[model samples]
Target: MTIIDYFTQLGSNPYFGAGFGLFGVGAAAALARKGMQVGMILFRRHYMMTLEVPCRDKSYQWLLQWITQHARHTQHLSVETSFQQHETGRVKTSFDFIPSVGVHFFTYRGTWIRVERNREQHTLDLHMGVPWETVTLTALGRDKGIYFSLLEEARSLALEREEGKTVMYTAVGSEWRQFGHPRQRRPLGSVILDDGLGQRILADVRDFIANPKWYTDRGIPYRRGYLLHGPPGCGKSSFITALAGELQYSICVLNLSERGLSDDRLNHLMSLVPQQSIVLLEDIDAAFLSREDTAGVKAAYEGLSRVTFSGLLNMLDGVASAEARILFMTTNYLERQVLALPLSWASDPFEHCSYYVCLCDNFI
Candidate 1:
């Protein structure tokens, strides 16, 4: 072959591509080996809070907010803004991280930290790559203190969203969240009632909080359960909401008709009741009324909830039920309508009638 043709043939040889491919593979392998060694060092020194812990999980969201507020000067970042209509009829705007192409870094107290989303686990994984010898225990403690301060700041933001409002919470599936925010600014003094019931209810709650030891000493459960029954639209719900505001307690409204509300789910929801909050179980008789029952029942009530009458009783008297400072069950039924229902639904069978407080004459 001619010399020029021979060189052309050499350039077109399969080994030319193979040689470049081998060089690329070798480079990637060397970089990967180096990365593995660095990763091992990091894995040894890293402090990770995974998805399992609830508080830790919430801290991820808090940390995201912290980074957003403090890391605005970052040259590379993901930032997003959103507007939501709150239950108070107010529009709320929120800023979030939009997750850029790669790791986003922020410096806290001269310590550089990286935040990345762990999509598989659905959590935020934070990494600080300081050498173990360089980070003293005191420095670590300072870092933790700053971390908790961020958590508290996030908590305060959540509280600010709910300030001066009465929230009615209900279960959707297995989760209980704020169902609605009632705009009723009706104070307890404004609730029109007879028989000194308003004063009596307020005094009862004050006594309970003031003398928790009294109940504990007597081996009595530190819980107060009230049954409010009256005609429909006679301010039963409003009265309860007013009472919540008076006590400065958030109201959690439990609707047994909610889907996916089995006995276990109901019990779990009740167990999570916030300290000093009022749990209102409205329409007590209506929840149990099915298609088999007569015309007065709430219509089209088919749902996935399997909350039985016995289950309701069990949850009310259960150990965790006592965690709630007060529990209220309201109904728009007279003495006979309530008495006609099964007595086994009562926490204390003998006090079935005792729990009932007649409010037939009280109006809004």
Candidate 2:
């Protein structure tokens, strides 16, 4: 039968006609849907601008803080609550609401922006031990300058919040993560050291920081090392913390005795330390008793620490060591033979002797 005759016969059958009509309708509907998708894609590609902020980026924190401040514009929200205890024994609680995992809209400088927060459940951020998250901001038109301005504003806000505070960081899997909320800056005067000792150390640090060029012009490594040795209760750690606050620098505390911390990982972590931060190695003498101890006897402290003494030496002044770095090592035992090697290896070693003396009235 001819095609036209077959269609004519099929049309005569009610069921066949209905089936054919449904097929035609479905094909048309599918074509319309495809056309709409293509149109939307073209429109977005040609007329829209998007910025993606990943959770790993510092800007992500800034953007989130900004969003939290402007939470009133969001319909869906996520809350982060924190409690702070004052010296007066009063506890204060704060709740911060931010845009949740969904599409949100807000107005920025007379422009409508769409924010889409998405979390990938299948993916995990090993460093944070959480699901991967991304915040995408979409705006109409092609101008990117507005986005830059917005980011700058967010950064300014974040910095203002962090002003006059000390940030502490710790290594997590070769990455430096902020340990806790930024603490109030401790006044350098509050810490008491031996007569004139504190001032001398502070002056030396200021001088070194001020004269970065002197080191560079002479082909010297732009770094400084300090060894604070004293008895257990001599405030060695407290002094380091106070010094960091006085210098307006952050602190990166690394534990050399951390299990699974291999030489390569230690090197990597040291090299990637945050800028304007002090690298603190507390209890340096405890990491290893002696160079020979770690070098000769592997089974003695098996699975304790993968870092070897030679690896530590290499990380200290090795070719991969970070420039413009300040390293501080504190130990209770100054006479430990293990310290001899590292002390000699330091480029600019300042050994501070801390001792306590009691003075009382003769009348007593």
Candidate 3:
């Protein structure tokens, strides 16, 4: 072939076309994710609080002002203290509202804690229920997490919890530890994957993102697992691309051989993932093996006690993760290690080759 002809033909080469196509897919995926960001703000929860703060009077005016001022500006906190039954002896009050995020107690253990409602039992024990939710609108500032500080200030005004006195603040469910991600998910690009199985995989991924309640509505954690298995040509890697695109989640690709990661490193990597994205663990079966086990020898699996298990649990069942993200695992084995399993990871998907795609080179 003449150099000129060879160069011209090379420009049209399938490999080159595929490479360019992959690039296009990558760009399209990035843009699609950008479009999805607008939806993140919708995830932000509306926080509400109802407690008996001293009325807007001089005695309790300082606390009331602090709470009202802070609540008016806080991103994940809100408050409403009504003038309930008043007594010349002391103040006692109640309220009704839901907080979707978490509660921050200033007295001690200032960390944010999710408010899980046990409807059957506590229906009469508490004053009000706070509903916490997820939201992505740029939460204003560090100082913006004002509810906790406000409580601290308000508590200072009250003497102590006594029969004659009233409670200044009673936290509802859903508290905010911080306005951010828990595990930083490293940016691992989309995987090479199979077509037919890839199609099914992408569909599940889309379902995961668009209607996460479909999983959570069943009372299960909002995480879904997938197992990708096939002979070399079936496109397990490329399928990840379509899946990432379909889900609008970031891809954090992990190598199983780099399995020696410390729990903190893995947590650090996972904490970077934003609200809606995928944390991809590829060749996960091989990753479970310990280094002492040489080639062809496998490591005897331990339960979730290992650092690996801790990391997996942190990523998979970590209370820190937002409800909307997806965690995906790819493996050649349709494997299930029931003996070492935890109830939290029951939704793991198995890799099966029953699904097939007809490619350009094969006509069936």
Candidate 4:
């Protein structure tokens, strides 16, 4: 039989023809998919503008907060709830919804924006102990200025949300992370310090911050340290928190007794403290007894903390220490054995008197 006649006979068979039809359909579908992918690549390259915010970036939270407040078309959602208890025995509950791991769409200034929230299951943020995530904002047009405007707006909203609030931060690994939602600012009057002591300390801090130029001209380190020593429950910590609120400054709480905290890490952390923040070291006596006893107590305290007395001293006044910084060290005991080292380091030591009194009409 001729070749044409053999092909004609095979076409007449139902199973062969069916198989051949299915093969052609598969090939066509694959070609279409490839073409579509190429088209999308071209579109994204030429027409789309994108801004990617990683989970580690400060802008990540701003963008997420903006999306939660402004994005109207988000379908997939993640909820964050916070509870606060008032002194009057009332509890306040709040719920916030953000875009989940998916694509969402919203409009801004007559422009359609696409947000893609992605989480990498296999990757983890070592510092935060959470999965890695990224939020990509894509717009149809290639105007970079629009993206900048969007980001600025998001930042403004975040600032407004945190207005009149005191943000608390803590050391995570070698970096500082926000501890929780910003707390309402406590009035300095609420803290009852003896004989205008709160006002005196507040004025001193304000003067130090305001006279940076004087410090620079005088070749001073532009740093200050305050020691608040008193018995427990004397409001040493409460006064510091109130002082931070008065100055509109964040608090970076540092724990010197944390395990695995090395001298190098301490130096690094001190050098890179967040702007307009007070570095607070609570219970300074518990961290280290005395500089002279470090060698004798090394074996017993080695497992609790790796930081040495010399290292602590270096971090306090070393070349690597941050400039224009304020340090607050609190302790219950100001005895020679407990605070011998810190007393020498503290520029101004304020002794807290044990008393209970409210200065403000309404105390928090």
Best by the lDDT measure: 4
lDDT of 4 by residue, 1-364 (tens): 9999999999999999999999999999999999999999999999998889999898899999988888877888999998977768899999999899999999989999989999999999998899999999899987899888888999999889889999999989878988888888888898787888888778878988898888788776788777677788788889889999999999999888888788999998988899999889887566665454555444543357778777877787777777888887776656632334543442323344332212111100
Q: Residue-wise lDDT of candidate 2 within 237-321, one digit each (tens)?
A: 7877888999999999998778878899999998899999999987766677544355644464445677877787777777777
Candidate 2: C-alpha lDDT:
0.79
Report the lDDT tens digits of candidate 3 across residue range 1-364.
8999997997889998889899999999999998787565444433333233222222333453333333333334444444433335465554423222333222213433222212233334232332222211122233444545555665664323222221111111111112111222212244433345555656655655577556656765665555455555555655654555444344556543452455665555555554555556666555555523445544444232234654666665566644554555555543433224454333334334432222111000
Q: Candidate 1, which segments miss by more than 4 Å at Cα?
A: 1-68, 74-103, 118-143, 160-163, 172-175, 178-186, 290-299, 302-304, 318-324, 335-337, 340-364
lDDT measured at residue 90 in model 1 versus the true structure, 0 to 100: 100
Residue 36 alpha-carbon offset, candidate 4, angstroms: 3.4
Q: What is the lDDT of candidate 3?
A: 0.44
Q: What are the runs in model 2 whose C-alpha is more than 4 Å off?
A: 1-19, 87-89, 290-303, 337-339, 342-352, 355-364
Q: Against the hidden true structure, what lDDT does model 1 obtain?
A: 0.60
TM-score of each: 0.65, 0.87, 0.36, 0.84
The lDDT-based order of candidates, best leading, equals: 4, 2, 1, 3
Highest TM-score: give the candidate number.
Answer: 2
Check candidate 1 and list the clashing pairs: none
